[model samples]
Target: MAFLLFLLCLILVIFTVTTMGVPNIPSLDPVNRFLKGQTDVSKIVSSDFQEFFYDQTLDHFNYRPESYTTFQQRYYINYKWWGGASNNAPIFAYLGAESPIDDALWSIGFLPENAPRFNALLVYMEHRFYGQSNPVGSMEAPNMVDAMEKSLENPDTRGYFNSAQALADYAELLLYLKNQLQAHNSPIIVIGGSYGGMLASWFRLKYPHIALGALASSAPILYFENLTPPDGYYSVVTQDFKEASQNCYTTIKQSWDVIDQLATTPSGLAYLSQKFQTCSPLSNADELKNYLKSVYSNAAQYDAPPNYPTARICQGIDGASDATDILDRIFAGVVAYMPGMSCYVTSPEVVSPSESVSQTSIGWEWQTCSELLIPLGITSEDSMFQSLPYDANVFIDNCVRSFGVGPRPHWVTTYYGGQDIKLILSKFGSNIIFSNGLRDPYSIGGVLENISENIVAIKTTEGSHCLDILSSGEADPEWLVKQRKDEANIIDRWFAEYYRNFRLL
Candidate 1:
């Protein structure tokens, strides 16, 4: 009876592989491809492709192949088998951020090893213009800026760089892979972080038919405006500066009131002006005032410690002359210095109008708040920058409308805000999960406030930035172990229950 069963399983495997159009496994090395001593039953397959089609825009009338075709698209598919010898496996497609592919692979350690077979698909679609993906004719800043501006103004041209189009491209790639691998019946899981996280949410909403589950980490869901600095961001910066001063420097903390009071004095104004002039972007007197004027309008939000790293703002020293002070560092010389090694000034002659607006409207807000107001103790004009709050209207207008390509779709999925998730999950019957860090400065308990039945928010004591950091040894070891356990358990149970029962409605 046992021998008969073995023979039947072998026949089923053959049939499954043939149906999928997958290459057949040779009899000589059949054992190598199947689970043996290990309790887990899974296999890994690698493939290389010359190129894949991507939608450049929302208008069906326009299309263009991604310009840089030098790098071959390489991916890995992991398969988890059932108890039988047949080749039935689920799939999990991971879309990582700007980091290298190797780092993304390492992050997958959070997945369960004992679970059923699954596929892990990796795509090397370098972010639009970065790395090998530069599509503009000239790499110069002026030319690049002009292209971006043109894209924003013309829908036909805007399709390639927008997030909506990127999501569509991924959907197309999945269909092609399904046909190529003959795995149309398999379930797929989509996951990502940062920008990749944004893509993951967009994919779930745009192509719900293809995905069983999605995990979006540190994703900024709303439009670009919401992500930009607002008045609240300036308030947060002030609070952070005040707190840091109190904690790190006794004199500053005790005399914080004096700093504010001094702003009224002419000598104080002169002193501050001198300090700002030294750090201005241009040495010219006229240019310095213009930059400072713009700074008042474009301040960033310093909401929490995680999003606003102390290194980015507060200096670890005392005294007005300390180079660590925000004023000294940002305006000590003719050119203004901002965090992240970016500058406030640009050559107007070569700047693209669209690129100029994006930088001025969104990027400047964050930079100004962080670099100017907090240090100077000045009031912010935009209120949203103070805290990471959930304003659906603001999110819709600033995040979705500003950064999205083409028109808004009917369905939407977001994982960043508990309030947003609650509302979305309740209305759409969607799955929402919050994978948070205890130490994360942003979105603290923000994921749990209005959770719906379909939403689940999980907290990791040591989790940071989409649970990317581990708790053990390196940065936080204990937190790492908890994160690993949580991830493994989540994936294992999800596969055992939800994935095993998934079917097209």
Candidate 2:
């Protein structure tokens, strides 16, 4: 009894020391001060060198407007010289996808790192409810993953994930960084891909003053309202298959109709239905049918090529070993955004037929459509949608829409209206560069082709999905010099012109 009492006393003392001794301050100022004079900025100059270090604790300026509840957030500072810094080389702030910024897998050098001319700053900010950023109680209980699933299950909660809120958070971070680093004069260039691309565009639109220029590659500018399922998404899939067939001409042309026929067959329908049922939360056929219909109607890609490889899977037959199987195989190979968290299962409860089928169909159709077809296009879309064989529409929708307000006017109806890019360029004007690949399935050269006087739509015969290096690989050195080299050069020139010569409206 005495020993037990003594142990209890010791445990209490440890808890008190941990909880009270250190204020759980999540910020960067303290760490910044510690490194103020330790690392020589002079020797650290240049972009070619990329290094990583841990800033144990960085201050994150947490704030709350009257609109929402107060929450604490953390921001970690990661700096790497782009190359020996020039007299006034700009600073490129690279924001990664849903993954943490510190993960080396998502490095900026998707291309070769040559003479670096900018300072790449990676800000590791936790996506709401992800990593250490969960505002509510423990992530273990109603944890980040579970919370996301719950949000997806509830339609009302899904609306919260908009681009506007995300931009606001980024703006807060930028303002904090400017004051903290004392970089008032430094030109800021913001770059991101996929969801990160959406953030970059929003950042440019909402906080133009903070960024000198912006690069949003493979970004999904249209994600709200008009987004539909199956058919809408299949249109892109069909186009991708056609393109891939053309590329591998001898292998797969004129086969899509046959595959389509197979898909509707008893075995084909049963296979897909089973896959959907197994992967989703549907209990009845009607719900499954509605889900399939919705998928066919709204969630398809429009800008991909007619013959990409991934899209070709849709052209296979649907028997026990037909097109559906091909789709399964292809989907298996595609890289998904969320692996740890199931993108398909949004709720903990088993999906009901009404809720399960409708939502599952929409989510699956959109995602399957994207994953099955988008890669076939020369340039990939900023975002790819794939139906997880699970009922995760609730979670997926929340992450996509709620993470931010999404692009203004939205990309879905805009593309069909032929007014999407035009509307955005009209507002932002000359500061934007719409770059694309000629063979790209989505937007195919259409995005840049529609460029108005102010915005520059750059198309490279080789540049697909912002992958200048891969696209330029096949070109002659001279042709590349004439075509691809000028793309970046033009971007640099445009920046100089804008900052040095032009005035904003």
TM-score of each: 0.52, 0.52
| Reference-based lDDT, residue 463, model 1 | 40
**lDDT score at residue 465, model 1, on the 0-100 scale:** 46
The alpha-carbon deviation from the true structure for residue 416 of candidate 1, after best TM-score superposition, in angstroms, is: 13
| Candidate 1, lDDT over the whole model | 0.37
Q: Which stretches of candidate 2 lie over 4 Å from their true place?
A: 1-77, 82-89, 96-115, 119-132, 137-143, 150-160, 220-233, 246-428, 438-441, 444-446, 450-454, 460-487, 498-505
lDDT by residue for model 1 (122-159), tens: 33343343222323334433543454444345443433
Candidate 2 structure lDDT: 0.36
- By TM-score, how accurate is candidate 1? 0.52
RMSD of 1: 16.6
The local distance difference test score of each candidate is: 0.37, 0.36
Error of 2 at 467 (Å): 3.4
